[model samples]
Target: MGLEVERVNEIAARVAASSGLEVVEVDMRGSGNKRMLRIFIDKPGGVTHEDCANVSRELGTILDVEDVIPGGSYVLEVSSPGLDRKLSRPADFQRFVGSRVKLTTRNPVNGNRYFEGRLESFQDGRLTLELGAPKKKVKAGDSAPQKVEMDLSNVEKANLVPEI
Candidate 1:
């Protein structure tokens, strides 16, 4: 199943690249006839409905012809990563510097595992975040640091915080 998923990812990346798109993520879920394959794509400006439809049409046909999926049937979905998109790669962190983000670390930093702040910079596999103001009033002795730094490997999960 893992190999099949990797093959689908490779194929999706190839198809997306041919169309001038970047494959953000490929996910497979469920089993047998109920399996689902989801591919998220993006580009410099953004992704359009036509882009999604075209990739879906082309990739779907290829998957059918290649038999990349072992199951009897599976659903393929193609779309853009939304505004609050995930940040999983180093490039993703670098590209979104200065944007607000929310993340969880694999291990606690300062005894806290969750953080939300503006991405100050990403360099040398490390990121520095400028912590946002507290949601509630802060006590004099409870002030948090203005900034925090951590290695990229420590980020268990991260996502852009949509700025409205």
Candidate 2:
């Protein structure tokens, strides 16, 4: 993370924590006059519009006063992670154990880089996935394994598979 992003993240975490929220992710995109700062936040039951507005109000002020964002003009958007929230951090994987997830690996695992399955467990910087049945029909003798394990380093991207 860049120094500015780290500083913004620190400020965001502080502001979010004050309102009983967790800062899921802090992203700074674009550049120059079109810079955009997006902060994703969450709580047990999910976040509300008021929660987002309040955090935006406070965090934006702090960022401006602290001059954490460098450029004076930038769009600050605060919102919940939503149902299909990202699973980037180890804590995210640990917290969502038993939930379905779709992930792409940095390299192929079992000749496949993509997987969607139940997160059975996360331990020792690795995760065990209980692979779900394939969407396509299986041949007489060709079938995927019931379980697979991979290190967290291999995961390039991952998101919850919303059951609903």
Candidate 3:
């Protein structure tokens, strides 16, 4: 099953790249009656509906020609990582520089297990963030928020917390 899944992703990536889409992730799920193949795609300008449709069409042919999955049938789904996409690598952390992020850590840091702030920069395998909340003020407007800094390893999962 693992080998089959890996091969499917390889074929899917080749096909998707041919169409200008970066294949971010791929996985096969479910059993006998409910097998599903999910593919996550992305690009510099971000993925579009048209991107999914085109990758689907192109990948459909490649999958058929390769005969990668000889099983009865499986569902294929292609999509973007979306706004709150998960960050699993140092590269991912670097990619999201300047965006506000919320992260969960496996162990406590500064007596807490979570951190939220603006991702300032990523260098030398380390990440920097400026954290705090806006101040509330009757005379000025709002109070200054607190600031915090944490290491990337302390991060179990992180995502871009879009401006609401």
Return the top candidate by TM-score: 1
For residues 48-118, could you state the per-residue lDDT of candidate 1 as single tens digits? Answer: 99999999999999999998886599989999999999999998999999999999999988767888999
lDDT of candidate model 3 versus the reference: 0.78
Which digits, one per residue and each the tens of the lDDT, describe model 2 over residues 27-142? 88898888989999998889999999999999988988878877559999999998899999999999999999999999988778888999999998999999998645566998
Native-to-model Cα distance after best TM-score fit, residue 52 in candidate 3, in Å: 0.8
The candidate with the higher lDDT, 1 or 3, is: 1
Q: Model 2, residue 82: displacement in angstroms? A: 1.4
Total backbone collisions, model 2: 0
Question: Candidate 2 — worst ten consecutive residues by lDDT sum?
Answer: 134-143
TM-score of 3: 0.80
Superposed model 1: Cα runs more than 4 Å off: 135-140
My TM-score estimates for the predictions, one after another, are: 0.95, 0.92, 0.80
C-alpha lDDT of candidate 1 relative to the true structure: 0.92
Show where candidate 2 strays beyond 4 Å: 135-140
Candidate 1 at 33: error in angstroms? 1.1
Candidate 3, residue 159: Cα displacement in angstroms equals 1.7
Q: What is the C-alpha RMSD of each candidate to the true structure, in Å?
A: 1.4, 1.7, 4.8
